[model samples]
Target: MVDRQYTAWRLYTVLRVRSQDWGGSIVVHQGMDNDGMALAVAANLCGAVFLGLEPDPAQARVVMRAGFCDFLVNTLDEALRAMKNEVRKHRPLTVILEGDAAAHRAEMKERGVYPQLQVIREGEEPIPTGRVEELSAMLATADAAHSLLAMVVTANSNAELRGADRAIAEIIPEGDPRRAWATGAPKFFVREQPPRRYVWLDDPELEAMLAVLPAGLTIEPLSHSAY
Candidate 1:
């Protein structure tokens, strides 16, 4: 029993603490990009339930298949209403609304979605898979700053020196962050083992996501022993 408690405590300590430190779970919903997807995966791995409020039906299907998040009200007004009710029920939550600086501010202010919600701007739409090699090189330069690295594998057949999936998978077993999407699978994985900080690596939408990442969130590279 002591060992079990120790392991649980240790895990809670090691996973990312930025969002949960505020004393609640986080909800991440970005535009038509995968940055939100990455956050959804990482947040869950860190033991925080991340709800994705994607508006596009096509994208919503992908979100469901990726096995990372929950469905929520899509529009800003509806989202705010839902969140308020959730909070009123004594549920502590930090909602991350996605959009750029201008759009994010305007949406929240114009529609009154502030306070309980944290705005994370949707990053630039990702580059077509053709740029995967270039993207890989760019990410490698910044790899030293992260702990665990994961990549988003787009279903593309572009002819490149190294395909996006191949490039990212070379470093991490799966270009995926959510492991065991199968029934009764582990919802998350530890950051160490192959450096999970790379979760945001090699995506076009990364810039926008970075642009609005809260100022205080510190990403320390986990362990590299798995490599």
Candidate 2:
């Protein structure tokens, strides 16, 4: 069953890559979170392979436990060396990178290692300041069913909200049944009622988001657990 799922995912990845310039070996630089692992699995399921470059042994173990083929490398340099070998072997079309993984990609680009390496940002793309008002206006028109609205707040305001976030938000608030906001990262929906908010922090979903958005952006998951 898992193998069949993997095959389907690989086909999906190929299609996605063909549609855009993004596809191939996805390297999850961040530790394996539920969302992160799901992304890795999705890529593999679709035939796209993944390499999780985690520094901490404990964290790396966690990722491995999640069914990811992970490596214990601390620095981007070390990770790059390993990743390059994988790239040569797999010859993947896209690479999914997070945190320091992106740094490695930048360095490789400078050294001319993988010139085609496209770096996807983490969170949603920035809604144009011109469009913030438009978004606000749209939100205002939302009814009880449209109460749930997905808002992407980044440390950097200039960044764009990810395509996934935008897409999720668009379909969530049509007729105003129950509000649900979707974004690349899980976020606490400010709505006060049953079915609170669905914040997807799973790696698979994030990877799906990454596959769609090839630029690094910070994605913060909204949770009641105050971290």
Candidate 3:
């Protein structure tokens, strides 16, 4: 029964990828071996073009046969030249939901009906419409800047959040002997850096350490603990 269920899931996933219109995009697989070859074959079967970056001549030949790759480039330069003329699709839209939408999202996710829907669940009270507008404005402002940095604060050292490029784990209290060694590395990283836009993430208490960062940084809160 478990095997059957797993097979059903795989079929559903293939169908989902196949249904998408990948007209002006190229799926670039770094190495054309193992899962890389699998992705190339799947993308080709879905009528999508792929670029396999495999240096091995023998392996490249194998993968090329498995799929109709636009460019089986061996180097970054070759890949760039191949993709230089291809047009790309615009960024996709993101749907942000609050309140009772959780149940509906869960149902779709469980049934693999809307496999492309990516959800970010925040356990805090629903954000006000005005606040949402404010956040949108802030995001747009940041987007216009040269660069934007995101920091995620969590108890789990290995915990990774999507869209967060950096992670702050275990905010030790003052006078704790381990505090020095625990946060020492991240200190150099956050201190005295060039002026840049920054955003804080997760637990409020733990993320307060950002306050100590250099005054030149424009730090703002993005979200609270989902717990």
Candidate 4:
């Protein structure tokens, strides 16, 4: 998933690089070779492909679109074949997930996906994105910004509702997401972004983002979580 920590404007800056210009970009489902697959696709000018453990089309589309490229999808079997073909020339896959580079290297070897793993350096190349891919990235970016801004709105305007969760606990339920926010949690229907991997802003950051919004511009709550 595109890093949720990216502010909307920042993500838009990242999204400006279209895959058609770079040839292609990868959207991995569960691993980095998927990015290698993207490299292969870009190198060979092939359409992006997606694979996963889940069968939900909605979820799969979300996973793939994060690469910000046009896609060519199929069954896992087909994806594997395509991946092999696309990734072979691009050995020692480029890993995009953010983490300690050494740990990512160790894990990739443990999984034996790519013995020739090479963590991309800051200057190696920015991950390439496409116009279609921008939609997913933009939405995730804007939604993340919204998540931060909403919390401030909820806290300031709904002070009476603070600590009132217990009264509504039965209606809301334990372990329910809403319970997490003492200030009526902003119900973000996270669809494309991976759960919890994206931005969760601190109060200071939220205050700043909220500050820039036009006065009285309301951010409405969704009735339910987005699937």
Candidate 5:
């Protein structure tokens, strides 16, 4: 048990606390682009496993290179099956859902598969299209302070990037004393767009979910958190 704990901690430090922390195991929606890649990298640095689901072979190639376990499937059903199998096999400590995961969560509950699984939806409509430039400018301002700010900006740029509605500008305040430069705040941002939503699984909650699995079944932490 001690060895396992130490290993887990080691993995966390390597993937999450190191300078290149990407965070933890993540289950991403396959259509995510370069911006999404940046976010996944960040998450992976933080100690997370990145599971990418996409029907497009080309897109899967991109995700696979980024430490993602690719699932080549067409319909939502196929995607769900692949995800379930991965979850069962890995018993991951966390599951960060992107894209059509909410639907899968619903289906899982209805079928009494992981009936206790809860899906929290975090999304909002795209800020009026006209606001894109305004948001872009804010990102530029934030970027001057922290390079990760640029990644946030890119992640929330559009549906093509990650299907996110919000942008980096919305989260970090300009000229704030707590800016990354001054206080080194964690890079946090989310998209509130419908259909394409982001879900963050807390560590404890994920652990509990995994504990329910039978013995001999264990999940590994894919990424770690820097702070």
Candidate 6:
């Protein structure tokens, strides 16, 4: 337990801390990015239930699939309502609420339940996939974008990537922070676009996925494994 606490503390830079009357602590992070994901995973590993309130359906699907939270509520009211059920589970709880923290915190306290709440604004949307030429044009712009190519394979590709089925087989960069939770079976993958360069080390499926990748941005397969 102490080891786990030390690990989580080392993985995340806690931006703020405050006392809670309910005998828990509040941990704050700047945004719902890699660090936030780390917190959710760490909390669960430490026997705390992690909950997230995300209103965007597309975003919610990604978060849920990644197991970022045990329970995800679409609204503040819904999150507040679920607190008791978490309390009944006899475990520490960590709640991440989107939007204004003050209002949501006040409402939560009014209901006589306090847990470690993570307040954050909406996260940036994934860059839309586009034609190779079109995406290449974006590089010249001030707001350049990049993609994190991830291969998420499922034990059964016929079914959705969920539960024990989904596993991240490979990530192009191979050193991305998001690889912290890579587990499960070999199935299919999803790409978070637009990547500066698409490198293929001989995965036909990954190669096919980037068939339209722009010229000059594709690298030839290198010898020897870097895994």
In TM-score terms, which candidate is top? 1
lDDT of 1 by residue, 1-227 (tens): 12211122222223332233322343343443454554454434443434454546666665565543444344555556655654455443323333242454456556544332232443433221211112222223333434433332222122221232233334333423322121111233221222122233434334433443333332333343222
Query: Which parts of model 6 are misplaced by more than 4 Å?
Result: 1-9, 12-30, 53-58, 92-102, 109-112, 116-227
In the order shown, the candidates' Cα RMSDs to the true structure are: 16.6, 16.6, 20.9, 16.0, 19.4, 15.0
Q: Give model 4's TM-score versus the native structure.
A: 0.22
lDDT of each: 0.36, 0.36, 0.33, 0.32, 0.32, 0.36
Worst 10 residues of 6 by lDDT: 126-135
> What lDDT tens digits, residue by residue, belong to model 4 across residues 126-161?
122221232334434434333332322222233322
For TM-score, candidate 3 versus 6, the one ahead is 6
* Model 4 misplacement above 4 A: 1-53, 63-74, 91-227
TM-score per candidate: 0.37, 0.34, 0.29, 0.22, 0.29, 0.36
lDDT of 5 by residue, 1-227 (tens): 12211222223222232234222223332234543444343333343344333334566565555443334444445545555644445433222234454454445446644312111113422211211112123223322333221111123233433322222223335643222221211222223221121212235534443444333333343233221
Which of candidates 1 and 4 is the stronger one according to lDDT? 1
Q: List runs of model 1 lying over 4 Å from the truth.
A: 1-22, 25-29, 44-55, 85-105, 115-185, 188-227
Query: Which lDDT value does model 1 have at 77?
Result: 57
Candidate 3 residues 1-227, lDDT tens each? 12211121222233233344544444433344544443443333333444444545776666455432444544334444544344243221111111223343343335433222111113422211111112123223332232223332222121222112132224444543222223322321221123221232335633455654333333444342211
